[model samples]
Every structure is written in structure tokens, then in C-alpha cells.
Target: MAGTVSGFGRLNRKRSSNKEGKRKKAVYPEKSPTSPLASKLPRKQASSGLPLPEDDNEVPAIGSIYASPPIPSAPVSRLPARGFAGRGNCVDDTVADNALTASQHAPPDSGTVVRPLAGKPSNSFRDANKRPRSLSLDTAETPSKRKVTAFSEDAALVPTKIADAHAQVIADEWNEVARQSGVPEIAKITFINEIDHEPVPPDINTLFTYLDKDCLSSVEVPNPPKAETMPCIGRHPAFTDEGLFTFATDCKIIIECGQDCSAASNCKNRVTQLPRTIPIEIFKTVERGWAARSAVPLVRGQVLGLYTGLIISRTTASKLIGADAAYIFQLDMDEPQDADPSLVYSVDAFRSGNWTRYINHSCSPNTAIIPVARGSAHESLPYTLAFVATQDIVPLAELTLDYDPSEAKTFARKKYREKSRSKILKRKRNQTPCKCGTLQCRGWLPQM
Candidate 1:
């Protein structure tokens, strides 16, 4: 009875082993000959149990325990290992097989996240609370900062604006006159206010007449009895036989050939009495506020223009003191030294002036200012100021004059020490750097 029981146990074990083998064969059946891809796909080698290529272009077949389903025509987007519904933890044989197949054919950097092209769906998983990625077009580049200058800050001040407006009005008035005189529109004068000076009163003519009366009190001369009978130009010490005034002489008591004289209106000595016939313009400069320039070439000793403005007593000038002294011409007649200084007067062109008011100072000047008596009343005072070209002036050359001819001469004194002169010059508050750009520049403009 023991032998028969042992034999039966061995038979039951053998049956169980055979049943397992049959079940494996049923799950993985042989490839069907009628399949469309069966002939084209590479087959696995018997020795290595790996797929071998039939040709370089042949694709290897995927081995599976069961038959594979048809692949879709369009590529399916890859899904993240962690699904949106928390279903990633569940195992699915189809998804695992697809992932494994993709990994074998993918580029080496399989762990990198791939960005989707436009119009394509993105399969990337992201937290709902996080911000979305910004578009590249929205990014902006930063700009560099700029530096401010001293001149720009000073220009913004209120006083400068008011001065500029006043200058513009004056320029417009003169420009109209220039237009009437046949000056081309493009070559018109423009006044620019660079300094703050007292404005000349609107009733300038009345003020000038009164000041002229006071200045003429010292040497008021009566008209000669034979003035109308004979030619005054020939007899006057100021004029030559040709009726031209000698600019070189220091004729202390010369008078204008006025209505009392027999000379004609076109007398050569009467250049200042007529309107400006020369073409000129006022322009802005770097070193000076405004400067005069000749629109046409001028010969040496030619009368350029007249400097006209309100005549004021020296006492009145003292009260109205400021940087405007630069525009004031001291009416010191070429009279005897013993004469009373109280009778001295000055012409202030801070306002109510002509184009010559814009003329700037220079260490070596191209022009000279000469006092000419105009009208019978000006005989004693020499109130009329005339500018004459000391040298031939080219077109567009700036018209400049020595503010103090005596100071200009000091620059050439052999005995004068440069250091001492510089120290004395710098002591004055209004002294400015000379921008005459001449070879004999004295380094500083003469102060009044």
C-alpha cells in the first residue's frame, strides 16, 4: 500500500508542470504568416534571442506575450508619470510597453523636459497654484541713465527765462527794420539776452534830451555869426578840407556840422546822422551772450554803425550799477584835464539800443569807438558814438572793440610783471576770461 501512494504523488506533480507550460504557449502564440508586417519586420536570432536586421532600413518588431493592437495614424502626446487624476500609481501594461519602446529609440537626454511647438498640445504636468511661463516677446531691455550739466541747470532758472523773452521782443523789432532795409530774411539779426541788466525805459528819447542838456552845461557855445555864410566843414577843426573827420587827432573840442553849417546833407563827416546802410547781424556766441558780425566785407576806417541809447548823468549811472557797466560808454569828452568831473555823463545801452549794443569786448579789437558831436546841442557834450573798422573786416567776422584802450596797452608793457598783473586783474568781481582768440589776448576782459 505505501509503494502505490508514492507513485501516485509523483504522477500528480508531473501533471501540474505540463499544465503551466501549455498555458505559456497559449499566451504567446507563433507569428501569423498572413499578417501584413510579418514579412517586413526583423526577426529575433535563435542564439542571442535579440532582433537581427535583415537590411539597414528594416524596422525591428516588438516582442509581446499577446498580439499588439493597431497604432494610431497621429502621434499621441506623451503623458507624465504622475497623472492629473492621481492615477499614475496604477500599473497598465500597454502604457509601460509604449514607454519602454520610446526610451529605446529616444535621444540620449531622455530626462529633459520637451517644449511643445505652436498649436500642439503640451503634456507637461504643472501645479495649479503656480504662475504660467511668460512669453519671450514680453521681455524688455533696460536703458542707461544720462548725466546732467551745469549750463542746463542754470538755463532752467526763472530770471533767465524773463530775460530771454525780453530779448526776443527786441530782436523781432530790429528784424522788421532789417527787412525794410532789404536784408534777406535768412541773414536777419537775432538778440539773445545772456546777462541780467536793467531795462531801458520806454521814454528813452525824453530822458536822453534831458541828460544831454546837463552834460552840455560846462562848455555851451553860441553859434558863430558867419557859420551860415561860409562852409563850416572847411573851418571846423574836426573836419579836413575834403569834409572827412581825422580819426587820429585828439581834437578836444570838435563839433558836428549841424543846420547852422553851409555843408550839404551828404557831408562825409555826417555818417552817424543817417540810418544804417550796411548789412549786419547780431548772433549768439559761446563765450559772450550776443555779438555783432558784418554781413558784408568792410574796408579799414569805414563807418560801421552808430551806438545810440539813453544818455544819463554819471550820478544816475552810479545808482543803477550792476553787470550792465559792460554796456555803458563813459561820455568823457576830449576836453582839458582841469575840467570838472561832475559834468561827465554816460550812455547806458542796457536797453533801447541799436545793433552795436551787441558788440563784445576783445583784447585785440578790430573796431574803435570815436565820439562825434551831432546837432547843435551836442557841440559841448560829444554824445554821438561811432564805430569804425580799425582793420579790414571779412564777412561773418565778429565786430569787437577794446572796452578800455589803456588796459589793452598794458599787456605789452615790458616793466609789468605777469603775476602781479594777473593778481590785480582777478581781484575784480566782473573780470571774465577773454575769448577774443587773438594772438595778443590779454587773458582777461577789461573791467569797468
Candidate 2:
């Protein structure tokens, strides 16, 4: 997020920095003739307080030096010094007295001149001068220093104009993404609450900001599908801490043939049922304090609730799953070697609801389920789950994934135990009733 600076404040700050640069440029004089003349001019004399002449032939006192015609000596004779008494006696009467004086005085044609020796310094010279004007080496904006320090200080701020331009480009890119996704209305995400020093956490509050009517948003994904009329299911599977899930759906499935089929026989039923256990082989560390959950068949990854978008892994899934703690599940994948399936629990999260009973028991679901693979061998690992949409989903539509891989009796028994155990425990603890109100709701549930 860009820093929070008022328009005028930013303008003033930019103006001040520009003025400083200009000031530095001005401080060192340049190479113009005037500057040279000023420097060359003899400074005030130490003994007489009179300005000294720069040229060798310039006479100190005009009146006495040119009192008479100049004296010319024999060709080899040395000229007599004229400052003392009787100094004129050695002169011969051939030379004009004013010749030397007139020749030594400044030429009449020199244009109206200001202080001499002042000119704009060259780039090299000005750069040298700027050294002292800049922050000290320990606190400066050298290339490396700029990268590190610019984040917090104006020393690093790109020129305000430059930053604004870059920001505009970013805004344009976001807008384009939104447009291509058929949700041009979402492009309004730019001017929400302007972030400053503090950062908003990746939670429901921050998520809600994207949905705020006043804020601008860009659709991060493209070509989302449309929804169909059906009895929308309300069950939301509890995503494991590792970000995996299993789900239940309210809609029924129909096959091309008369017989009921979970998926097209050609594609195989790999995606239809809940896998036994997702080996913890499909996670990757993307940054410090953050890892990504990857999907095998789709070859896509997500940063859990953070950036819910596509990503790639520098390290393989096994490396990622090995780093985190073990997770367990009741189902297992069809094959051990395949990278596809629903092992993306590391990238999933509950859409928010009852913390418990999030494990939706489904006999069959329209969506495909993948395992959260942690290790190659997969023993002693915890189960994580993830779901993919078989068809289009609408906003606020119930999201589900097939959780129960077994038959009805087995599925019901496991769910009954899980629900009753939690319910009895809640009653013993005198907890507030859960309000989910699912048909099979255990008479009480946890409230948000």
C-alpha cells in the first residue's frame, strides 16, 4: 500500500526536494568567463587594503606612474624601477609614457560584467559538491541503501510524480483484470480506506472491505461461470488449519446413461469421491511465515485465505508438506504417485460458520475433492481437504465438497459420532447453542 500523504503535503514535499537539488546545483560556480575573471582578480592586498592588480603590467597608482612620457633605454639596458625618488633620471625620451599603462588597463570592449568567476558548475563538479549535501554514508540513499531504507523514509520515495504514474499503471492493470473477468463493477477497489503505516490483516474484515460498496475492486479471476436454480445447500466444510477441505452438496447428479454416475466414465471417477487421505506432499513455502496450498490436477496453488490466486512453487509439494505438522483424514487418493486430486487442503479455508461440524458428510457431491499431501509415505499424517466447482457458483452460494467416501450407513455413523460427541461436550460445558439450524442439526451448535 502507498503511504498516506495529503495532496498538498505531497506536493510541498516534492517541491522542497526539487528545490534542494536545484540549490545544490547552484552552490558550486560554473566554468563561465565571468567566474574565471572573478577568481583571477587579485584579492585585496594584505598591507595596503587596495585591490591588487591581476596582470603583471597593471600599475598600482595611475596618477604617478603616467606623469611623464615613457623612457626607452638602450636595447640591452634594464628598465629602471619607477616607484622611488630620482627614478626618472635613467629614462631615454623615445617611448610613449602611456603605452604601457594603456596596454595594461582592461580592454574597453569587455561587456557589462557582474562579479567574475561565477558560473554553473559541470555535472561532475556538481556531483562532487552534492556529496556533502546528502545524508551521511551510514544514513544515505545509495543503490543498496535506497532499496532497504526507501520503504519507510522519503529518502526512498520515488519522486511523487513518478510514484503517482506507477500507481496509475497498477490501477490500470487491475481495472483490466476486472473488465476481462466480466465484473467491471469491481474496478472500484482503488480508493477504499487508504492504508498508511498500519496494515490490514488478511481476515474477514479485510475481505469485507473488498465487498464494500464505496470501495473499488478488480476481479482477480476471469470468465467465472453462471449459477443455476437449485436448492442451495447450506453446509460448509471445515477447512483444516493446513487449508484442506471435504464438502457436501444439495444438488443431485445425473449421468449421460440412465444409471447414476458420479463423473463421466471416460475421465474416470478420480475426482468424484473423497480421497482416503491426501499425502502431505502438496504444499510449498512461498515466503517467510507463509506457505502455499497446491492442487495437483489443476496445477494451481493458493495462499490459503491470503492471495486466493494462482501460484507456482519453487520447491516441490513434498518439501512443503514435510515442513509443516502432520494432518489426518478418513479418505485416500486413488493412486499414490499422481499429483492431481484434491490435496489442496493447505490452500483452503472454511467460508466461515460454525467452527465445529464444518466437516460436511456427503454421499456424493458435484465438486471434485483433492487430498492434502504432506509426505510421500503418507503414514502418521493428518488429513486435509479441498474442493473444486463442477459448475458455476453464485455469490453467497453454499460451497461444498464431498466428504463421506463410504456408503450411507457408514457415513451417517461417523457423522453421528462426531456431532453427538461435540454436542454432549458443549452441553457439559454449558456453551451457547449453535444456530446453524441444519436439518440434522444436533439440537444445538456453536455460534460465531
Candidate 3:
């Protein structure tokens, strides 16, 4: 498209050194369906399989996202072979060029060049024989939210570090807060930042405990609530284990078989086994407190990590001390998702959980939690839920979740959506002030 614009010359000829009849490969980001600037978009035939993305903590069917097939497949044939369209197919000389264009181009009032021999057509006023000055990246935008079908093929595109003060700390020390973040060897978590005299976080090991995996034994420690608290974790203690879907009979066979689920190409168990492939960071914020972010550019459908925690029931959670009620995640839909059903299980991350605890809520979040079942088959609910990217995240863009995705939700969510829902109590405050800074801020976090 770039080489062959409406007013441009045909640029499709092969180079002298290129092998005869051989073509160079190109990878392009998918055309945004809602982009107003898109005049012509390459045809894309979306394929559907496990639509919810490859997440290790996901159940067989959690949610759906369209998957683009291999580039050599139907998707690639529709796009051009070469040339970046940054200047688009045609670079219009006369633009209502914004601030960036003005800084990089000669002014219209600056006047024309010296006369050449009689016949040549005059160049545009903005054009000159000399090269333009380099522009700042601030004026440029990253295609973080843009879709790309051929991620693996675009390995040559190296990601650059961004320097937004809000999105990232202005300056930082490359520090590791904890020795291990519970992520796999491939996935990494860097504890960073010390800008503006900010205090470095104390070792998390000194806080409560570090649990790489969920602890099922609620074995009443010398202290209270170290292991999962319950009659509680094993078997459904509730009168009825109604709406949850346990592993299928075949799924149970493999769980008992002890064979690595990877051996089977069609293994349904693989749905919840996809670990994170990107690196993440835990950074402190000014007004909002601690948060998490990706250390590099990330694709839209990638899963970041599991939201590991203690297994506690809604009945048990109701008895949680005061503000501690803010961290229980309702497990697989044991009850209708839309209704505030009194019965169900929840994953409590207050005392024991992983890096996901640091992820804050945003009105317009880039990440979301999807349901994911774990290795244990007998457990009535799924273990270790996951944080899936809702859109492509640029480097250092804060990772966020919508604590209250919809107002018509469950008790734990409504209760913990913020610290509280009403500020009328004791003439003090009830709900925590939301500082997500999105245009869609609901004025207050939905809390009860």
C-alpha cells in the first residue's frame, strides 16, 4: 500500500541482489476496525478455536477473543509485501500539520527555493533539499492497542522503553524486591523505581508469607489464617455444589494418569496451563499506591499471571475482619454471575497470594481476570485464576483490573470493589477514592 499510493510511482520492482522470483516477508499490525483514519484495510478471515486466548489458569471455556491464523494462511495474502505505511501510502505535502509537523517541517511563510533550469515543476513550500530534524517520541504514539496477527514473525521489531511520568517512574533503580515472584523461569517480575525520594518497598517476605502455590491446608497455625481457612477447601461443605462445572470424566482420567498434559495435542487440560511469556514489574505510584506493569510491549490476548490465594467460601468470607473483606475473588460460576447469590466459594488473597495483589483497579483497565482451573480435579472450584490483557499494553503502561466490571454483580465484588461504598458512616468515609484517571471514571469505586 505504501509503495503504490494513488499519486505515487509503482515501487514493486525487485532489487538487483534479491533472488529471482523470491519475495521479502512483511508483518503488519491488524487494521483497527474502529479507526476512522483507515481508508483501505487488508482482508482478514478470523479463525476461532480456543477463543479465550492461551492461558494456563483458564478453564476450557472462559471467554472469547478472535484469533488470526498464520500469516502464510488467509491473513497474510491480503497485505502488501513491503514498505511501512507510517507516512501512509501517500505523504501529502499540504497538511494541517499539527505541532509535531510544524517542528519538523519548514514553515509555509518561509518562501521558496532558488530557481532551477526552466522546465522543472516547483516543490511544495514545506519541502527543502535538506533533511528534517528528528522529532521527539512524545509526539509519536505506540501501536500498543493495535492488533497484530503475526506476533512470532515480528520478532525483529525491538521494543523501546518509554518515559511517561504517570505511566512510568521518571528515573529508577533496576532493583529486585523479592528473590522470586512465583512466576516461572521464562516469566520475570522486576521490582523497580526510586524516583522523587520514594522509599524502596520493604522485603515482602517480612509481611505475611510468600506462597508460590495455593495452600489448601487451613491447618490453624500458631497464628490465624496462614493456610486456606476452611472445613472448607476440600469437598463442597455447602449444602449444594450447584452451578460449578467440575472436570469431565476424560479430564479426570488424565489428572489421575499423572502424564504431562502436554503429550496430547487435543488435551482439554492445556486450556488452563499457559504461563505468562512477558516480563512484568511492580512499581509504586504517587497517589494510588503500589501497582504492576509490563516490562515490555505485550500482545492483547496474552495472560500475565495467576491470581493465586486462599480458598474461602462466601459464608466464611462474610466473617472476615473489617477491611480484609476486600480481597476475596468468587470462584467459577457456582451461582449465576449476574445475580448476587448468597452461596459460593471465593479465593482470598488478603494474607496469601502472588504479585497479582499489587494490580490496582481502573475504570478503563488494560487487564482483566478470567476463570481458570488448576491441576487438582477434585476441587469443586478452579484454582489460581488469571489476569488476561484486555488490550495490547505499551511498555510501562500500568496493569489494571476492573474490580466492578458491572454494577449488577456479586457480594464480594460489590463489597470489595473499593474499601467501602458509602461515606455516611460515622460522618467519615466509606468508599475509597478512585484515581484511575480514565474519562469513564464512575466518580466512586462501586463498594458496599
- Using TM-score as the measure, the top candidate is 1
lDDT of 1 by residue, 170-273 (tens): 34445554444333466455443222211111111111121101121212222222222322223424433332333434332233444443344344444444
- Of the candidates numbered 2 and 3, which has the greater TM-score value? 3
Best by lDDT: 1
Question: Which sections of candidate 3 miss by over 4 Å?
Answer: 1-186, 195-207, 213-271, 321-323, 336-343, 374-376, 379-383, 408-429
Candidate 1: where are CA atoms >4 Å away?
A: 1-172, 175-248, 335-342, 375-381, 417-430
> Positional deviation of 152 in candidate 3, in angstroms?
46
Model 2, 336-411: lDDT tens digits are 2232222211211111111111222222322333322211121111212334433443332232222222222232
What is the C-alpha lDDT profile of model 3 across 1-448, one tens digit per residue? 1111111001111112212222221111222222211111111111112222254333332311111111111100001111112423212223212211222211111122211111121111122111112323464332232222333333313211121211121111111111122234445555453331112222221122323323332211111111122112233211112211222211101111002223233323332233344676667665565678887887655656656555443445445433244455554232233322222345555444556767776767777555433232232122345566767789889998766554313323655455544532323233455677987564444443
Candidate 3: residue pairs that collide = 56-272, 56-273, 56-274, 57-372
Cα lDDT listed for each candidate: 0.38, 0.20, 0.35
What are the candidates' C-alpha RMSDs? 52.7, 40.9, 26.8
Could you give me the TM-score of model 3 versus the true structure?
Answer: 0.44
Worst 10 residues of 3 by lDDT: 70-79
Compute each candidate's TM-score over C-alphas: 0.49, 0.20, 0.44
